[model samples]
Target: MVRSGAGESMRQPVRREERDRGEAAGGGNRSGGLVGWRPRVLEHKVRPADLRAVGEVRRELRQLLSRWREPAGEDLTEIATLLTSELVTNALVHAKGGALVRATVTDRLRVEVRDFAARRPEPRAATADGTSGRGLMLVCSLADAWGVRSHAVGKSVWFELGGGPA
Candidate 1:
């Protein structure tokens, strides 16, 4: 089957479950959203040089949860936001190329940043006077689980908040 058609516009690929939920929630092509899915997934391109993208990622995450009408507590949202900022900021500063932030809400909340950097990130030894090098440490302490995966052209840094099945 072809991915496009006459008078048809190309669209982002979305999971099946997302399509149903988005339609049911009035967030799909039938209404407002182009593709609505529960455990809503959203991604945005980032310029590591721009420090502001971090907050923008966080804000978008908040808006997503709100749109889903998830009963997620503020605490959940806050932690998710903070961790997202750290990961995205790290990617922009270190990834050495364009980055993308993806927020996935399944049974739990997860935020991941993908960058074109091949090196894996590790928490550096922190000294009392150090002003940097604590991002991953915070993720470890707060997230239920977090880790990185290497890609041929880059890597993705991710963290999960709260508990839920995979």
Candidate 2:
């Protein structure tokens, strides 16, 4: 069964004054530090079975990373893109509906792919000659943290990488 725990938190909405201040400072901390700084979020939803849309999603993520005041560096960005691709591809191929991708960036980056399937993914040992079944393995090995969170309708597979507006 999918674990519906961890990585859940209630975040207060950004106040108007805080937002104005953030905007004034280019959406980053005034002293370019994370203290009291709000994270930046980017979200996208892919239609069911639209595998091609994965590329678009990756492109959008890359764009978002680029626009950040302190991008997560090339290595982190690439890792984020690859891991996101894995989650999204899995959701589209194995799940019954589209997936919602949400990315949050602060001093770290967290990416979640939510789908309408209640099933949780299991990592299988990939054969040397086999061409499939390595996504979850990569996620487990690379992400600083990763887990599954079940929603009322489905579940979300998420992973995090540390490195951002520092």
Candidate 3:
């Protein structure tokens, strides 16, 4: 057995015939087990004020989450989409600076929207003439857990949906 540069023993000896065939085929065997096994980390940045960008974010997130082993069928997807839309919309409407949406999938899916606004979001009663003010309510109803965190520069409103079918 010959040792490679990394001091690992080669599993097999290369014969001259095999080498000629490999050279003819323009290929070489890499003596390593699963050389590329990097873990995946998904992170995205977006300006929440741009409605088109927000929609794109949602679409990308849905695609990413759908590939994962989530047990909650459409319920998780619906809740994530609705809450993300509302949070991003609220940030665009109320926050001073733009918002950043970050999504991560572990045992559960967590969506966080950060904006440069010190004021915490509160649900208000919509009047008869009101056309809005129900976003937070919808978020609360759909998400397993939702809340806001205040920071010196801004705040991040985050929500989580547990894994598994609804």
The prediction achieving the highest lDDT against the true structure is 2
The estimated TM-scores of all candidates read: 0.72, 0.75, 0.68
Worst 10 residues of 2 by lDDT: 11-20
lDDT of 1 by residue, 1-166 (tens): 2357676767776654455588768744532343454367889998758888777778898897776545678888888888888888888777678698888775567677899978899988678898778889888878887778777889888887756522
Q: Write the per-residue lDDT of candidate 2 for residues 1-107, one digit (tens) a residue.
A: 33445956666666433564777777645435656666678899899999998999899889878866676689888998999999999999999789999997765
Better of 1 and 2 by TM-score: 2
Best by TM-score: 2
lDDT of each: 0.76, 0.83, 0.72
Candidate 1, pairs of clashing residues: 18-37, 22-36, 39-105, 48-92
What order do you get sorting by TM-score, best first?
A: 2, 1, 3
| Candidate 1, poorest ten consecutive residues by summed lDDT | 29-38
Query: C-alpha displacement of 45 in model 3, angstroms?
Result: 2.5
Regions more than 4 Å wrong, model 2: 1-37, 163-166
When 1 and 2 are scored with lDDT, the better candidate is 2
